[model samples]
Target: MLNNRYEILEQLGRGGFGETFLAIDTRMPSRRKCVIKQLKPDDTTNTAPTPGWFEKRFQREAAILEELGQNNRQIPQLYDYFSEGENFFLVQEWIEGITLSQKHQQEGNLSEAQVEKILRELLPVLDYIHGRGIIHRDIKPDNIILRASDGKPVLIDFGIFKEVNNINGGNKTVPLGTPGYMASEQAAGHPVPSSDLYSLGLTAIFLLTGKTPQALTSDPNTGEILWRKDAPHRPSNLAAVIDRAVRFHPRDRFTSAQEMLTGLPGSAGREKTSVVVPPDTKILPPSRFERWFWVIFIVITGGFSFGFGHPIIKPWLDYLFPNEPTVKELPLIEPSSQINSFVLDEDGQTLVGGDEKGNIYLWEVATGKQKKTIAGQGKAILEIAISNDQQILASSSEDGTIKVWDLKTGKERITLPNQRGLIALALSSDGNTLVTGGKDTTVKLWNLSTGNLIETLPVEKEVVSLAINQDASIIVSGHSGGDISFWQKQGSNPYEPRIFPSINPWTAPSVAVSADGTTAASSSCQENIRIWKDSDWKDSPLQAGSSADICLIVISEDGKIIAGRSSDETIRLWNLNTKKEIFSYSPSSPKSFDSPRMIALSGDGRTVASNFDKKIQVWRPSF
Candidate 1:
């Protein structure tokens, strides 16, 4: 038994610094099977890092694994990590499936369609990790396992040998990866994001030709692998994409996973089935026949007006019948940069948005026209809050400052500077108090009129989200460690927080509070959405969770409706009273992986606005 709980069943394999084993957890009632990786100092190496350095590296890797596995379903889930004596071990979810290498051995070779399917499904996962600044150094057939439950590929290992870098006065370079699959730059101890793409391209080649990189012939001068002749069934377009991915120089390859995804053959042509009614269609009642009769009458009698070709008759008909007030008929607003954060006006007639390029757009939702554009902070906007009266618009950015703007004048009101970057902001209903939270692990109440700090409440962890009740008597704050705290204002010394135990540690939770302070909801990635009610904060049956993992959530003002975005690139809304989903959709025309998604719902729960890349889409949801 390892770590006094896991019973070793069989040895899986061994790498340079670690060994893996299939084990069973004795602590669980089901005796669940898992994989345990053991890491230790290798005696064969000439130079080794000190024990402190090794321990730090092990801890860092464990944290990364925990974060990646928890947020993504394509990666194996990390259950536990601990140290026993000088050896470190990691327990992970055991995927019951065969590796691509084993699949090739049994099935001969994969067809072109099969290879394309893998590329399409796995590239988004790569984009996700790369967005967080992580590069998988090893991408090979053996490292990808097709899960038995579903055929999706689950990436494993994560390059355990990459941790052995130049540390503790060691001068020799240690290049770590499989000889036949690693990129040329990776082999020289310097790997870029494109290095992983290079290996993935070669993996595709191996799946097609049933030959590893070593067996393929290469150009002597250009150093490009020549394998098109071996895979005669492949199309020229796919071949071209693969060739570019495996280019000789890193600069010549695709810079990011999103670019490579777009380079695929049919990526642009793919789209989700939309339920939105077309703009030309009219959703009218029994007066339709009367309208059609008037139309026929005007065309016949207004021939003199129509013959002039001035559209005089059409203007008269338009005055009789106005355009339908529906989201489908509204003009689409396409901004220059991705919208990072946005909030809808309480009246549901206007939308305020902040973009990645630090610009604030005030859009008229009725006509979808850009009314004003204010130059915002220098960095990407983290959060945007509209006061209850819609007079003050406050936005937080990575530049460590908050800017308050006057909606009527389209001018700046005040600038609140912070010591660190602010992540969350909330405004009181009366527009007098503003609450802000940031990486500094403190929540501050600021007087909006004077731009002065009223009070600061220090917490044990950095706050990730903040919300205030209508009366400003209750404050809901979500911390980076997954703990949601509720603070009540009693007197001058009413800053102490009533803490709830951490939900999923280190995964920031999206939280919202009702305007009346009667309801609150929060959700962490890959976890169930929890609802709390009453002053005691007891659980309510109106909870909702999904297998897709809800990442962003917003509660309606009355607390009767909630909407959120999930990891599967879909938006969903639910009615808290009935506990049923009202509507769901994939909002983008051609979905792309952009950073910092923003969503807003009208107080009446009739309108929803969301950011889809460079576009802002508004919808009057109807089932």
Candidate 2:
């Protein structure tokens, strides 16, 4: 619009103090596309202009961007920077690619290889910046783009240039970066180089969870991120590295980007892809702004220590004084000797539950009183599947054994041993066929009455979720690789089993097959409920709804309702056709406690049951 040399195409987004746009720089004959950002100064402040300070800060930031672009291929090149009236504008290369945020939505939560690849690509960029005494105050998924042409990452938006920020004596109050990705020190405006690492770690977490850090729930007191349980594919090695990177205190985090990169698992004895830092390298000493942060830190620390001070404070005073309190007391979830998995029978009269200590409880559904209790096979019950008639209960244990308990007698009828990995159990309606799937990549069928081996199912992948039709004729099995196998009872191979592809296999750890065999509903780490229509699993879904914490899922007999237990101790019911949550049941929990592991829907789909740590409740849906 200014001088007719540039054309505004579309508004990209708005930040705290600026607006971003996509524009074509017609100044060049080729009319190349570029990004234009308008930085507006606060008009409300009446402080006298510090003669040329703003201009000097603007020029310095522009020069820094140019320098970074020249040295690093992953950074966006600066094209032009000019001021129109009180507002400033920056013109830069338009990255023809998707931001990591967009890529995450297009793809699933990043796989481990993707996370490692990201760490490998961007850590060096951080090393380059931190070496020059500049911290990329904003480093979230949105600011990092995956260039389509070369498949490389590009870091953008220096955000309030390091010098321009009023880090001196805490004058700048505007929050920097996106909320979830901002480090504690950055929020306090006393960021060190490590603060960037903290933001990077949070970005990695976002990729893994397909969720912003803000959506994740943290422990009330300790403030530790309770992310592991929700993100299904966190490998311990990578998780440990990320854990240290995002430690609450900057001092407790990796000192430099180089250290964090080198500390990764495969960096040992390898050629350095990332820039290397010198030994004993130290950042420039804290400025006037940092003294304020230190005073704040000391006061907060002293307050807490003295609040519980005296005898407990005296013993640790010497050590705490010498070092920051880096040790975080990650709160422990107090274990209640209670129900771990439960299921409601078709009649809704019998409520059977399996506890962490391998005990079975038969409760009167109407009165909520325990009718019988039997000690199980000395292992935690991972899942419980009830027979259609409410006569038999199948309890899958941590040790790969299925204990079949008689509902009437509360006696162990049979203990079916599986010497493989984790197992999922499902009992058929006629009380005849039993299906057992294991991580060992085997699905076996048994005669429920005698617990004898029937026929082995031909499933080539590690089964994650399993469900059976009422008469044991149709079984739907979801595998670790997002492919589903359907088994139909007949022929020499009998149940003709065929694999059907679905959402990223890692996500569909919870699946439910309608009793009538018309529909199958599945949920994954992506937090969306996918309904696959009768044997034809394709790109288009019947209906997809946003959801989470789907550790256990089940579909109604008519395939009209879908329900699941999420991580937040809630059981939600969804109308399959409308893709709406019909109703939900959530229970308030203590600061630290166990959560439900299993949830189930009855054969008629009229009842739902969930384990409440120490108790199990069966409910009739209001919707």
Candidate 3:
């Protein structure tokens, strides 16, 4: 028995400074099991080392562990800590599951999908700890417990965590952590946030290849591990991300856990890495025909430009393409902040835009006049939706709340608290039903009139986009996991949802469904826009001739036209029946085109609106 309440059952493991033991708490009626660690001061006869320093270090690390466990569920809770003479003890929540090392030994190597899933789950935990300005100097397979209760990975053994404030040139640097798992900088006694990521990358490689890092060979020139050859079946994107994470230098590794998470396979935002070329690879000059083609094309264009100039060529070009509609830039009375989200009325007569300054601007489309300006949520707006009657406006921002405003009065009507900020919103034609998809992995339906919670539909992943059909009978949602789900209302019971897996299952997809609920479109960073038709959901291709991924898609109410904005800062419209592009517009300034919802299309698809820099550009088809 130790600490007067904990009864030791068996020894778990031993470290350089401590020994862990399995124990039970007798104070509580439940008598829960916990892991107790006994810390001892180094008895070496070195003048530099002292018992006072060891005591302070243990207390500081124990306080950090308690704080981390209380905040995150993935970390083990610290029960108690105390000093008995010169020795110290810490009791922690015992996780009842196998370690990643033991799991690997029992089940062999993990698949690419399994490795990615683990990375996604653990990165958020890393982000949480990193946000507190602490670096976990040790991250390895043996330190991670696959919790049997929920199958979630629980991070453990923060024995060598260094608070950023405690790091300075005066403090003696001591390299600590398991061999082969520690990063180069960490091994050299300077570990940053990315050093944990480096260890994680090696752990992932070990899980995938079923080989220890010590067994893996390293490049003599670059010092990069050569483990990809053993896991050759892994996707190139995943390989590239791991390679970047395990770079030799601290700056060469991912800057943060969130950055590495975004670089994961299927994420919409991918990080660019240097291309590795083989020693024997050679670059050849352009072929004779290719060289001649480029030379003749440039010469002909230059000759025509020189001969006609602007004055003569402008009229001739207008005559040759008389049907091409000219894009009109809207004039603002005052300088406006960058617009992040906007919506157009059903008739395309009015435009409502939200800017980064948390202000909403209403405009008259025909005359380019500012109708009214309303102060919105005090955060960058992410999405906005207008009521079918154009009488009500709903906007969501980064502040995690939804504000409903009266279009005519420009006064706030109601504010609904949406937990974990919404990414997509859909309003029914009657304006009575509002459907929202959020980072909470749930789609919520709310009553717009009384601001009452209606229903909650559970989804497997975080939803990125949403659309509702006429009569509020059908709802379509796209998820971060590249899933498209259809929720159909049958006689007032809870909506029955049917999930349809997307072709690109790793990226978040943007979705748009027609008012009739017969046609739907979905697109992601890894794939082109795909149109799903019929009740069974047979999909067809809609080629926009753009290689960039489409981040936002809007379909006409009648399901005849669909418009999408690609990552290349181009907005395009296509006729659903003919599958032909009506018009493609690439704005000169891409300042406001950085994210989704910066572009809006009317239900008729005749008018398109997008923000370029501080100005809104509107376009109409010339027939």
Off by over 4 Å in 1: 1-330, 491-493, 544-548, 587-590
Q: Write down the lDDT that model 3 would get.
A: 0.72
lDDT of 2: 0.67
Cα lDDT computed for each candidate against the true fold: 0.72, 0.67, 0.72
TM-score of model 2 vs. true structure: 0.44
lDDT of 2 by residue, 1-623 (tens): 84457799999988556788999998898999999888766546522122343554566568768888888889888888888887777788898999998998888888878898999889999998876646788999988999999989999988645334332221122336654576654554445578789889888888998767655655544555667776778667677778778766565577678888887778885332233433322222223434455445544645364432222222122223332211111111222466676776653445677788888777655446566787886988788887655567778888878878777687778877664686577776546778888777878888877878987876778887788876677787888767777777744557777676755645556777765566776665555666667656432343354365465688765566777877666678776766667556667565233464667676545567765544555655422
| Better by TM-score, candidate 3 or 2 | 3
- Residue 10 displacement (Å), model 1: 95
Which 10 successive residues of model 1 have the least lDDT summed? 164-173
What is candidate 3's lDDT per residue for 342-393, written digit by digit as tens? 8887646678888888899988775577778998888888778886557788
**lDDT tens readout by residue for model 1, 1-623:** 99789999999998666799999999999999999988776545523322244555566567778988999999999999888987788899999999999999999879888888888788888887765546688899999999999999988888643453333211112446675576644544445567788889989998899978756766544557788988957667777778877775555677667777877888886322222233422231212433465466556655354331222333224423632211122345677777888888654567888887888888877567788898888888878888755778888887788888897677899998664767789886557788998778888998889999988988888888988877677788988878888887866666657887665685788888877677887776766777788667865534545423677788776677788877776777887766667567774466765666667886546567776656777765532
Candidate 3 C-alpha error for residue 553, in Å: 1.0
Candidates 1 and 2: which is better by TM-score?
1
C-alpha RMSD by candidate, in order: 25.7, 27.2, 26.1
TM-score of each: 0.47, 0.44, 0.46
Name the Cα RMSD for model 3: 26.1
